[model samples]
Target chain A: MKLKVYTDRMSQPSRAVIIFCKVNGIQFDEILISLAKRQQLAPEFKDINPLGKVPAIVDGRLKLFESHAILIYLSSAFPSVADHWYPNDLSKRAKIHSVLDWHHTNLRPGAAGYVLNSVLAPSLGLPLDPQAASKADKLLTKSLSTLETFWLKGNAKFLLGSNQPSIADLSLVCELTQLQLLDEKDRVRLLSPHKKVEQWIENTRKATMPHFDEVHEILFKAKQRFEKQREMGTVPKPGFQSKM
Target chain B: MKLKVYTDRMSQPSRAVIIFCKVNGIQFDEILISLAKRQQLAPEFKDINPLGKVPAIVDGRLKLFESHAILIYLSSAFPSVADHWYPNDLSKRAKIHSVLDWHHTNLRPGAAGYVLNSVLAPSLGLPLDPQAASKADKLLTKSLSTLETFWLKGNAKFLLGSNQPSIADLSLVCELTQLQLLDEKDRVRLLSPHKKVEQWIENTRKATMPHFDEVHEILFKAKQRFEKQREMGTVPKPGFQSKM
Candidate 1:
């Protein structure tokens, strides 16, 4: 049996897994667990990941969740994958692990919280917590600054100065891509200050290419839907009840 | 030159790294960065880890942060250490990675949040957000349930059924060990119902042995300090400002 991946592109991690599999030409079956529809909360999905989050995989007898771990596992399990994705060199691998471990508490939360508060919550009919959104924006800005000053210090296009994009780049770039869902003003305000980050995002996009574009289609569609809703004056009320 | 570890045992991750080094007999210089003194915020420490987090390492030319990444680096860097700590087998390694990855969003936050909110905040003379504490407790309980029902199934002595404690076990067991700072009533409430989890904690402690007890001395001291304060009827006032 082929490896099975459970995901929903709306999730940044899920898109990261999808792109990793596609770019590496790893054989896998993709199963959607839509968060917008609350499909992830289902019993069957919970069996695969008790936490009910996405980007989980089943390869042979090994069942795994967490995109970073899955990325590492896939790279190792399929030796055919280019080593640049997750290098075997001890220091380089540890650096990648450092980037990933730092990501959860740093970039992921910063970017995700900002996007969710500024864009997704409003579209999903949830009250936009202004205080929370501001805090998230601060975190997002700080994270971008760190990315520019620390990780992208040299002329390297990817994180950790890697010439080729690693899973860290994929995971992080996918996270920032959620900014596309925000309005032009909010997006620009949140992202425009960091020229290096913008360049890095484009670099990551170019490296990943058509697969990156393909995996992110759901986000594109969501942006369109939100825009259409705004034009139609169909603004969702605060406390409007629908599962996110 | 020996590996230099910058840590403060008050931090859970710091203790994990300290214990891992002690148990595995990895040589290192221990530099204390007291979170209680805001020493992590110092310029020199920031040079080591811009994020200003504890449990960073300087080994040869490699500079790494985040305890999980540091643990991986140490295990790989010191090949003489036991293999069961981080097996070379593909599936076993992936399973360990899975547990580590799952840990960040689930167990670490839950246990850490509960300790911080219910115990640390009050002890530090900060307001205990009851609502946040309750939510964290729920997450902690749910995490323990998942650990018992899923990860700890069978007669396994450690996570992933390994007879020897993996780095994942060490990292997780250290996170929960923070519960020691809580009052006996609160600690019992948070831990008593989960029998398997309690056993797993004991199992992990036994596997890690004297090092575990030795590394945890600071937490025990903090508990004693709190108890002393309680006995003197000199509880610190809410909104009291002190570094932590």
Candidate 2:
């Protein structure tokens, strides 16, 4: 009954969970479930997470899904490392939770959905619906602007007001890294236009995930596979048309 | 120097904070900010929450916004009660957090948004667009089905696996109460269609807010006022069709 994590390395959520375990010294087992191969839909993993989503965990008798929830659980279980990552100071912790909550509803959906549908899917040889991609791009831009203005502006190294990395930075970095698989143009847009964010991302890479190259490479390969699938007409392009 | 919550009693988020405090026995002074009067936009209040959203709290010198964030903060601050509401159990708590997180993105936006635009605004003599209302209705229905199949099937009383109430129930109950502001027929549709959910709602109301009569009356009055406004041509009907 060892602590086990079920994940695909390329998924942003899975990457965040891996980093959380690494930073906190949580030694467990890894069960790789490849989404590209539709391994998540397998019956065995379905019992652990009925929704069939990844980055789920089995810690002894405990089984949990959702990366943010898993992060909170790990922090509480391992309080020795919680001060820097989760923070006991109520306000600081609240700030992190606030950002995480908003990120799930706003940034995560917009960034991942838009990039996948518009840039990545098109590159995969699927039909590219420019309008949908543009709408998603706008949402991502708005989310980034809000993050910059409200949370990340004066912070030194992390998204939270911390010199050391927090779970907020971990989650965000994983997501931003996943975005690189979309298109080179989006990569530049995310990294260049927001200079502070770009620098902060590099900071996170050094502090938390020095071996991020491997993860990025996996995601890059995923992009190539998606493109091949589209070229083979295995998947239909997203239906997106301007209503206006 | 004491805990202070800036809220409008009429707001859904504010009610969440208030209910959280009430359930957990965390006493705090409340600073009522009338949203209808645009009091939250006042520069002084904006200093506390730049988002200008109510249910913002100040504990000592630390200020925080977002109702779910505030709930997490309180749980961290008062660890003695964490097991009771937030729960330290990894898998159980993850289930609760997932439900709460999903509620914000799905239920709160569509269900509560519809109440505000269709019923409340119209009661205030503001125009209500049939198209927007239809979209909200569909979104809410879809959300309710998810809740039924995924969340509330075997719970009996509370959300998670808990026999007693928890933060999961608090977050969801507050959102569910927003539906009461809808027209009577809509309320029935929102409530009666789901048996377990309806029972859970009733149990929560009995356990937490006993005098549902008063709250229901206030909501009814608000809806009436909105309808009067609509009749008086004070606000235009929803101009854009919802894409939900």
Candidate 3:
């Protein structure tokens, strides 16, 4: 039986998992759990993931959530997955793990928090809080600088100065894509200062081609749709709220 | 040369790393980084972990941070460390990783947030906000309840229904120790409902033994000190802030 991947394209980590599977040639069925529709909360989905979040998987009888765990499992469990993604060498793998863990508390919050408070709030039927958005932007900016100043300080093309893209690269770069949802001015203000981060995102994109863009198509489209809605004056469905 | 572990006992993750090494018999020198003294911000420490967080390690030239990453690295790199702490089996390791990642956004924030905004703020030279503390309490309540209803629902003695404890157990149980700082009323109010969670904490503690109590000595002492000060009309040093 093929691995069953339950995900929503709107979720950043969800996108990373799908792309990882595609780029590495892991066969799986994509079961879209709509975040906007509140499908993740359905009782049936709960059995698949008790936490009721996306980017979960069902491998035979085993159930799992948290994209990092799923990604790590896939890399280790699948023989076809390339070694560079999560190297077998102890120290190298540990450094990648460091970046993945760091992404959860640092980059994930900054990027996800800002977008949720600003752009996605209305669509999710929540009020937009400029003050909260501003706070998130500060965090987002600091996280971006950290990625630029330290993680990318070396000549390597990706985070932790790795010449090849690892799961960390996939996860972090997917997180940065959330910025595309922000208004042109706010997005530029938050990210333009970090030149290396810009290049790294592109490098990661180039490394995991076609699949990266293919999986992200929904996200880019949403950005365009939200832009159009804003031009006409507004958009916020607000039927529910999710962590994102 | 000894593996250099830079940490502050006041920090939960720091204690977890130190205990893991002691429990697994990985010999190392403990270099205390004083959170109260703002020593984590020192230039010297930044070289060890650019994030300037406690529970970082320098294993020769490899500088690593984030307790989850450190724990995984230690288990994999150290020859004497037992497999149960981080089993070599792929499925088992992935499940543990899921819980570790889950802790960051869920339990870590709930436990640490409540303590910082309520009990530890004054000692750390910050103001306490009852409202923020209340919010954190709700999240903490929910997290603990989840721990009871799901992670420990099976017959196994520890989380993931395993007879043996993994690093996730160590990391999460240390997070719960922060709740000890709460006043008796608040502490009981928050933890009383979750009978399973309470028992699970004990199970993890017993699994690690002498080291668990040995390492948590500082935290338990702070609790007593805070209680005495409160009885005499209060405590809040307002020195500086750390994540805890």
Candidate 4:
């Protein structure tokens, strides 16, 4: 039986997993658990993942959630993929794990929270909490600064200072891509200070290519819808409030 | 040079790393970074870890932070250690990673937040936010329920249904151990409902043994100090407030 991946492109982790499987040529059925409809909370989805979250996978008897865990499992379960994605050297692998672990508390919150508060929340008819947005902005700025000064400091193109992109790059860059939902001015203001980060995003995009664009099409459409609604001075009907 | 581990037993992750090293007999020098003194923000330690978090390790050229990262690095770096601590099987390893990844957003917040708000805040001269404490309590209760229903449902000694304990067991049990700082009545009220979690905690303690007790001595002392202060109607001076 082929692997089953339940995902929604609206989620950064979901996009990351989808792109990963596509890039690696992993055969899997893509089951859409629409975040816009809050379908992840459905009982059927809950059976697949008791946490009621998306980007879950079912392979034979193993059922897994948590995108990072699924990514690790995929890398190990399918040996056909290149080693650089999840290296064999103990230290390199540890470094990647470190980056992934750090991403959850560090990069993820800032990136995800900023987009959600500044753009998604308003677009979704949720009360726009300025305090929360500003707090998220501060965290996002600090995280971007750290990305430049620490993770992406060296000559390498990727987070681990590696020549090739790793899952960390995929996970993080997908998070930053959510910034596209913001107006150009807001997006530039939040992201322009970090030149290295901008370049790294481009680099990751180049490496991932058509698959990146393909998986991100949903976000692009959402961005357009949000922009159109803003221009008309109208609020879009609330979509699923993603618990990113 | 032996591996240099910077830790404070007051922190759960720090204690986890210390106990892991001691039990595995991994040669290392323990350098105490007092969280109370804000020593993690020091320039000297910042050089070693830009994040400046406890439970960081400096092993030759590699400087790694994040306790879970450290645990994975150690298990792989040292071949003499038992494999069950971090197994080699693909599915088993993925299961452990799932727990660890799930831990950051789920268990850690509830476990760590509850302790910090209900106990650590008052002890550290910070105003106790009753509202925040209540919110954390709810989250903690929900997490404990999930632990019982999902992770510990099977008749197994530890998480992952292994006869021997894994790092997931250690990391989680350590997080819950923070509850000891609470008053006796509150601790029992919070813990009594989850018999499986309690058993798992005991199992983890037994598996890890004297090292667990040795590393946890600081928490025990702090609990005693708080109880004594309560009895005498005196407030203890604020110690360190950990951000974790």
Candidate 5:
């Protein structure tokens, strides 16, 4: 039996998982768990991930959740994946681990929180709170500044100054693509100060070509829908906020 | 030079790192960066961790931060450290990874947030907000419920139903220790329903022994300070809440 991945492209980490498999030529069946409809809250998906969140995988009897962990497992379990994704060298791998762990608290929350509040909130069952959006926006900008001045210093193409993109690169870049859902003006305001960060995002996207684009296509489509809603001045129905 | 660990005992993850080193007999010099004093944000400390958080390690030339990443690196670097700490088996390690990753967004925030807002806020800088405390309290209960119903099911000694405590167990148990700062009533409210969670905390503590008790002494002392302040109707001075 092939590896099975349960995900939703509309989610950033889910896109990372699918793109990882495609990039590594790993065979896996993609199982969609629709977040928009709250299908992930169903009993069936909960069995795979007791937390009922996306980007879970089943390899034989082993069921795993958490995209960073899934990405780590894939890099190790699949012998064909290049070492650059998660190197065997002790110090190098530690640096990558540092980046991955850092992402959870810093990048993931900032990017996801900003998008959820400002753009994706309505469709995803949340009220449009400018206060909340502003808070998340500040975090997003701070995170970008850290990446530009600290992590992506000098001419480094990826985090930790590695030329070969690691899982950290893939996961983080996919996270930034959520900015595509933000209005162009908001996006520019958030990203304009970080030239190095901008370059790194493009580098990561370019490194993981067609597959990266393929997985993000759904997000692109949703962006269109969001734009139409904004132009039409329609509001998403109230209640049912995903506190997840 | 021995491994150098930069930490403050008051922080949850920092204690975990110190305890892990003590348990594994990984000799290290402890450098305390007082969070209460706002020393972590200083330029010197920022050189070690740009994110400016504690539980960072410098093993020779390699500098690593993020407690989870540091734990992962230590387990892998020290051959004497038993495999049970991290495990070489792919699936077992993956399951542990799941718990660790899940922790950052769930248990850490729930536990840390509750302690911060309800108890530690005044001394730490920010004025207490019952509303934010209520929000964090909700997440604390929900996360505890998940642990009780899902992760701690059956007669398991640790998460993933393992007898041996892994890095995830250490990281999470340390997180729970912050609840010690809560008043007796609040602590009971948060943890009483989860009998298994309480037991698991004991199991993790017992498994690690002297080190665990030794490291937690500082938090215990701080707890005393908090109690004294409460009895006197005094408040922690304002002007320095750690956003970290």
Candidate 6:
């Protein structure tokens, strides 16, 4: 039974899972779910994931959703690559888990909100509110400040220790890189007082360059979609952006 | 090395960790961090967790934060109770992991938000906004619906499966039981329009009656605190509520 992943390059989590697989040299079939087409809501996809979210996988008889869970599964299933990706040291694992939790509430939500409001929402013909933009800016700033204080406070290069890059780095870097593509104006928020984070971003981008050319290309297309949607005045597509 | 848990009974995650230890017969010392006294922000506690979030545990030289990580650690350390609580089956474990992820974003946030806005906010002498109340309502409804759809769709008894309870059930039950005493309005919402979820709630309550009693007592006191603050004409606690 081959491992199959359902995803869209436009979603950061999907990209993170893809990058993780690529870095580990794991072979898996990719089934792209187009966010613009609302392909995720289709009945065929819904059977795999009742929640109708992407980055889901079916590994033989084992089916899983949630990017973090899939990351862990891949790590356990492929033990040879696990040390570089997940690390077995208890404290290092804790550090990874802590950042992952924080990502869900803070960075992920903020970045996604900014992208959706500025790009996806507008593409769906929804009215963009400057107030929400300001709120997203603050959320991103606060999230960055927390990362600066908590993770990047010392001279630590990676989130965990000195040199080794863990799954935490991969997950976070993918999300932050996506945030940097959220239009030029919105991306300016990334250059706040977080010098350490800025340096880390530079480091991660360099590390990811060799393996993630395809990912970068996909994200570039997503940025292009954002721009085209804005120019075409197709702000807020039907049956896509929930009014409530 | 003894495990040390910093907790407040009013916290759902803290309670879940405590229940895990109790069920497993693992000995641990408890240091209650008073949310009301703002002890979590003090420099002393900040040394351990700069994020200052609870259900933090220290075992020997290793310290772990985030309830899921702690639960995973405890399971690895105590294999005897592991099968009963976390389960060794790969697919079952994946299912639990997926639900745990859902718990963080869905039920945990929405339920905690409702308690904060409706109960905790007022207790700290802060102003109440009906807008937050409505958002909390929508979030809770959606979360519970998904919980029923994903976690409780088939089992209806335990989150994992029949015959025995798992960590997923322990964590989710704590969230619902904690909310039951925090706000009557939230309790009513759990009952109406979510009969499956409500049934699952009762099943969990009946299964863990003794532990529920112990945790419920503290939550009941919290309810009193909210009422006292409401009588004083303040909705949200002044310093604790988000200034933004």
Interface quality of candidate 2 as DockQ: 0.53
Candidate 3 residues B151-238, lDDT tens each? Answer: 8867788889899999999999999998888776778778889888888889999989999999999988998898898778765432
Q: Give the true-contact fraction for every prediction, in order.
A: 0.78, 0.58, 0.91, 0.89, 0.84, 0.51
lDDT by residue (tens digit), candidate 4, B122-196: 655577665566767888989898898899868998886788988888999999999988777777777899999
Ranking by TM-score: 3, 5, 4, 1, 6, 2
- How many pairs of residues collide in each model? 0, 16, 10, 1, 0, 22
Q: Write the per-residue lDDT of candidate 1 for residues A1-244, one digit (tens) a residue.
A: 9999999998999999999999989889999887878888899988788777888898877778888889998998897799999999999999999989878877887888877775578555687665566667778889889998898878888999878988899989998999887766667776788888899999999998899999998889988887677667664322221222
lDDT of 3 by residue, A33-139 (tens): 99999999999999999889999999997789999999999999999999999999888898998888888888898888889987788788889876666667778
* Fnat value of model 1: 0.78
| Model 5 agreement with the true structure over B5-84: per-residue lDDT tens digits | 99999999999999999999999999999999999999999889877899899998999999998999999999879999
lDDT of candidates 1 onward, in order? 0.84, 0.73, 0.87, 0.86, 0.86, 0.74
- TM-score of every candidate's chain A: 0.92, 0.85, 0.94, 0.93, 0.94, 0.87
For model 2 chain B, give the 10-residue run with minimal summed lDDT: B235-244
User: Pairing residues by index, what is the TM-score of model 5?
Assistant: 0.95
Better of 4 and 6 by lDDT: 4
Residue-level lDDT tens digits of model 1 in B1-244: 8999999998999999999999988988999998878888999999898879898999988889999999998998897679999999988998898888878877887888877775577555578666666667788988988888888878888887777888999999999999887766667777788787899999999988899999899889988887677567564332221212
What are the candidates' individual DockQ scores?
0.74, 0.53, 0.84, 0.83, 0.78, 0.55
Candidate 6 C-alpha error for residue B238, in Å: 23
**TM-score of predicted structure 2:** 0.84
DockQ preference between candidates 1 and 2, better one: 1
Task: Write down the worst ten-residue block by lDDT for model 4 chain B.
Answer: B235-244
- Chain B TM-score of every predicted model: 0.92, 0.84, 0.94, 0.93, 0.94, 0.86
Can you give the lDDT of residue B23 in candidate 5?
96
Rank the candidate models, highest lDDT first.
Answer: 3, 5, 4, 1, 6, 2
DockQ of 4: 0.83
Model 3 C-alpha RMSD to native: 4.2
Superior candidate under lDDT, 3 versus 6: 3
lDDT of 6 at A142: 84
Residues B140-199, candidate 2: write the lDDT tens digits: 887877777777757557776567877777778777777755555557766677877788
On the 0 to 100 scale, the lDDT of residue A69 in model 3 is 94
Those runs of model 6 whose alpha carbons end farther than 4 Å from true positions after fitting are A224-244, B181-186, B206-209, B224-244
Candidate 6 chain B weakest ten by summed lDDT: B235-244
